[model samples]
Target: MQYPRKSYRIYFILLLIISCTGERSTNSKNNDSAAHNRTRYFYETVKATEDTREKIIYLDSALASIKNSRDTLLPLLLDYKIFYHNSLKEYDTSFFYVDSLISLSGAHRDTANLAKAFYRKARIYNYLGEQEEVFSNSFESRRYYLAAGDSSQAGRRTLEMALAQISGGDYLGSQETATEALSLLEQEKDSVYFSSVHNIIAQVYHERELYNDAVPEYRNALRFAPSLSDSLSILNNLALVYRDNKDFDKAIATWDEILGKADSKTKILRYEDNRAFTRWLKDSTQDVETELLDVLRLRQELDEEIGLQASYSHLLKYYLDKNEALSRKYSEELLKLTRKHKNAGMELTALQNLIPISPLPQTRSYFQRYIHLSDSLQMASINAKNFFAKIRFDEERKQEEIISLEAENRIQDLEAQRMRTRTLIGSLIALLLLLALSFLIYYLRQRFKREKIREVHKTESRISKVIHDELANDIFNVMSSLEAVAPAPVVDQLEKIYLRTRDISRENSDIETGENYITYLKAALTNITPRDSRLIISGETKVNWSRLQEEKKIVIYRVLQELLVNMKKHSGAKLVAVSFAENNKFVEINYSDNGRGLNWKRARKGSGLQNVENRLSSLNGKIEFESREGKGFRVKILIPS
Candidate 1:
């Protein structure tokens, strides 16, 4: 779901430096002593104010209060400004505030808040109907979020990106991006976003006429509905799906149920019109004309353009078979409304209806108009898709170019730091080099040992990089292109490949030997284990992990990881168990699986088994394997503590 990082620095040197400036003069300090509290009060008042101008006034005051201070309130105030101006349809002003925040966040090297700046800009562009900017900014926000390890925020950005793609007729990309968002949202259990993602997926399926697939996804959206309005919206979508698939009975039943609970005049009107149209479709003899016309007049009174489009189309369809004059009337009304709304798809539908009923001269004119508009819309749709593809491609290309520039920058920075260190050491050595030769020899020997340890970690990082850059990205590109064209089984298999490649990349990456190491290790093991198999882990808390060398811990992790991979691939295991124990000198792990046993005597050591052996050998560890023809596979590993 995530690409290889743009900031791939292998080393970090932490140095804290404080300026020697004296405390500020009280007279020179800003007027506000409690800047934080005052700014918070201003922000809260803005949130409570419904009037746009009043809200902006409070936001401006808050911004002025923090104008000279780089206090955290600066970005908070700017974000509020952007949100408020955007809602008032003042996009230029919204973008101005967004740019200000982006600059401030960048100056402070705050990637998290920088991501917010871009996300806010994406929202503004989304409202302006600029799909490319929406997708680009949303993706930019996601990159920063992923860099910060905030998957929940990254997922929200991705969901917005998916919505933009779908709006631009990029259905396949939208579906794939939505699914990726779901994966990022897996740990958050955020009902609102969960519902949004599934709703996106359902809409994609509905667009493709995969009604059966869309049905369950809508149900899933309903399961996570966070409010009554959201629930009613999803229920309306579900009924539409049923209606589209021609299961009219189910559609009408769903429509009637939601009609009872529909709280707003708009929703009631829409749902009522939908139910009446669906009933007419179910039984052409049904008399719904009176209800449909009344809804149309009400929609006209309200000037509801969207509702009127549906009403015009339904009335046209009803009169198409019986009343030529009425059909013509409705068709022209639909065409005029669609053109005014600038809805090309509905405009095409209106033209189609008009062409069939109009006189010869009008029919010819209508047909010509339809052809021009249809061809133009089709071309635009196709170009929109490619433009999006170009946007994504350009970003990947830009990232690739940045990789080397960043690497060189890091190298130069490191070299400059080393030069400073060497100069300091040179001065000290000139005075004491010969005086502490014995100590110098011991220090050099320890430095060599530390370098060797670093090499081990560097090697792990290289392997992870190879898997990600060489395998995962390439697989992702292939999946993106093949998603709409490839057979279902092939796509599914490729998806599995992508998942496994990512897992391998993560599994072989650097190990964290901190207190959370055990938690990460346990989660890794759980992830690799087959979902169908029951896994029992014992004595994980009993082991004295602090006693083990960091290198030894890495080896144990890799060895167990290999075993799990081998089990998942080759062992048809129903139940698997791993037990850990450690004493004064050694740690031992026993892994067993209830599956078709391997032949211990003639076990041709596979790559996975060999890798496990090599990792254990590097740590001076020992392993024992036991298996038979019809029994089960078992492995016991021992490493120095």
Candidate 2:
């Protein structure tokens, strides 16, 4: 019965569009100035009017006035038409005007107008729940916004994109987009938009059930809120997050603050209901049922469908364990309201809630409806994600094509320049010859240095093997022979020497290649892992080991071996998990362990860690460490494939 409520994403988008008038300006010639003024007056009148019918009449008058004017003002007129039709919920008419606006703006290369047109199209598609169209138009809008040098508009479009991504269930992508938008808005120093971005980020985290991460983001939103109403809305969101996180005291306190400031009767009732629910969570002895019923009466009196739906949902959940008849009654009411609103998400929840409390004869029908709705919702979500992915792929492909065309043009230009330079080639032959001789000398010196380094490594490997095979075995034999009579200190010293020699041997060992490389790597880790600890490996089988070069493999093997050795020596770890994944360009390895983590101040000075860094540097790779004392340790390594 814990329904995932829909956010006020559309409200924010609408607020942004209405409040941002700076982006609307006429760049038409003096000949059209009179028409432009008349159009602007009519548009302003439409915006100022509260009555939808009057707004429509003003929009029509503006469109009529501009019909005979030059095409310079056509884009603005089409925008008005689209906005009017959208407000009237005449989506098909809105879509037609959007198409007309895009066509007109594209013909004139009016990037700013085109951006607005695409943004309007995205908003229309969002209302229609056509998420694929929403994302496609949003991307186009963002591109045109950037082309128009409107970074603020582009940042807002990015927030819209993030919302589309969230609706498609791409939380990771949404979070990344939200972060990018947040960075842009911070640079712009626009407090209102910054708060909106923070709210989007918080919603992403909240949807992902990362309540701890969501809390600070909602607080940040509240800190930046421009108006008292906006602040109260953010406070309510924060309270909801706190309640979900089981911080009942904070949730109740936030609701109290909201109730004190909220002037609208519906808002006051909603906050009171929220407070009652939180108190019930803190202590079940509270009269949550009576409080919810009172709120329901007020919502019913106000004809607040959304608020009524919420009250019914809460009452249904409250009665679920106590009275099946009352549960069914409230569930039916919730379903009716959700159906009236055509809220598929809440309808799905209502169906789920009803299935359990339904009568035995009707249970099968309810189950069937739930399954059908769930599958349809899932498919819709999948289609939205696929459409967005396809749009991105197409965009990237077009960019690559443009780059290829530009590269060809550059090559042609360079070829023509080469022909012109042919006449001067003979004069530079002597200079070129001198430069080639210098390059040869440098290459020889570098090759000689590399050969010397190779010889040194070979010598070390030979000495290490000799110590490991001959000296280490002899020492172990001596220690075993004297075990009964040897003092404890002497035995300890011998054991330390044996371990050091073994480590040296491992450090100098050649990397295993061919088909057995992964097996060899696993064996190396197993040797160092403690018997009481667990080591889990995943995704190793997914990588194509043959694609990796010998040098990279050697570096990776050495680094992982060093980490395991360090863990075994110093960390009292109970569990370690390592996962490997590869994309087209990079092989990523994630390593984590439950252990006494590194002291960050001293971790950089460790010789073993330094060696790891050196090996990674040689392969042009990178390693990132995340750990705190008494917490778990984690390392992420990325190397070119």
Candidate 3:
């Protein structure tokens, strides 16, 4: 049995709907599974420790797990890989990961992830000592963080930026950045970041030897420190600042506090070394040499090069008078360590320590080296200060310019708004005026149309009366009078009178429309053409006359009749041509006659031609007349379909 056609269509539609639903369900399940896997891998890697190798293993495994998924999580994983490689100091591998993270995050418009990625890149660059790259990437990260509305992250990055500036010897710039970071973090009330910012500021002042400025900043850092360990670290730095300022009492007290709180042997050794130095400064006769040597041995065992440098410097200072060999050995060791660490400030200090202790020639050589290094360092510091001053000046100028631009823009906006308001008002007024003019024109047009109709009615009535009462009666009377002995001229005159009366009646009658309207129009034209005239008609059959409205056809019929009549009565020539054609929107009619051409100016003043123009105007049509002395007359008419 065959199914009905409607049933077949319904069955086919049901099959398509089920197929589409099944396909969508399968895709949704796949997407969900992929999302779950990505989330699982990300969590697994994030929970891993900071061991670079271990982090790399986890990240590699996670990447393998989601190798086919190109989602937001992919960039996040790549960012973690960059951080791990950077921690391992594998710079080339780290940069590769950085590039990958940037590409993926940028492509996905993951602003938060991109910000974190740039921040990691900045940290790596900082470690590589690429000062420009560090500054640029940090700025980029801060901008992206702000754009992502992660203000807390942006504040933290600002602190990192301050630290970077400090490392680059831009102490003033560092101080400014630290203050900015402080302002941002204060709004957030982030105690940890606040502590960090204060610490950085204090370090900057301390480096500049502004111990008075540094003391308050360190106190602030201590007050805001979030953890015991962080507080201890700040206290240690505070103690060092006191020692540098020669406040031996405060320095010893701070070190005692650090020693009491410090849990590890390394911390105890560090504070001990610092306290020993402060004691030696206070009284050179104190037994600080053994304590310094003990600190040096401990630092060497721990392989802490930085701590060893500090220990060696203190030991050399202590042994300067008592043991020349040990003093020189410690100085050499300090210089070597400072150079290895690329600490120019410490190297300068070490050179100064060595110069006075060496023999005549060696002392002279050391003194010269010291002077050269000092001058270079001084010049660098001066340049850094100048650079920071220029930066501040430019920033201030930019702020002023921005303020000026904002004022100008506000004025422009107001002016534009006023112009818009004026334009709108002008447009409304113009529109109202146009409507009033249109109403007046329409009123006049309707009034004129009514008057024309009334005139046509009156003419029709008068013509009908004349035909019935006067012309018909005269024709009959003449016919009766010459019935038996009628001359040919009298008989012809009577027949002419009858035909003229009939033609007048037809001209004034209502139009025949529809299928037979074209035939009526053709007959009217043929009747008006004189028998002697050579009528050449073209394009008449080509026109779609059936599409034309009845009123339009009547107007065309009247205009053509008027033209033909005028041609026969005034012009004695024979040839007359008429053509009709149509376009998409209009029908065009061309009529010409070889006749005594009209006086162009006088013809425009004639009432009969004006009536023809009025009739065409009522139908929204136009007519053009071409005539010159001794040339054929031509008329072109266009009527909307």
Which candidate wins on TM-score? Answer: 3
TM-score of model 1 (CA atoms): 0.58
Top model by lDDT, which number?
1
Hey, what RMSD does candidate 3 come out at? 17.0
TM-score, prediction 2: 0.57
C-alpha TM-score for every candidate: 0.58, 0.57, 0.60
Q: Note the Cα lDDT for every prediction shown.
A: 0.84, 0.80, 0.79
List candidate 1 segments past 4 Å from native: 1-51, 65-69, 186-189, 401-641
Say which prediction, candidate 1 or candidate 3, comes out ahead on lDDT: 1
Q: Compose the digit string of candidate 2's lDDT tens values, residues 529-594.
A: 889999998999989999887656766777888888888877889999989999998999999999
Off by over 4 Å in 2: 1-71, 186-189, 423-641
Looking at model 2, residue 297 earns an lDDT score of: 90
lDDT per residue as tens, model 1, 309-352: 99999999999998989988999999999998788888898899
Q: Model 1 — which ten-residue stretch has the worst lDDT? A: 9-18
Candidate 2: lDDT of 432?
A: 89
TM-score of 3: 0.60
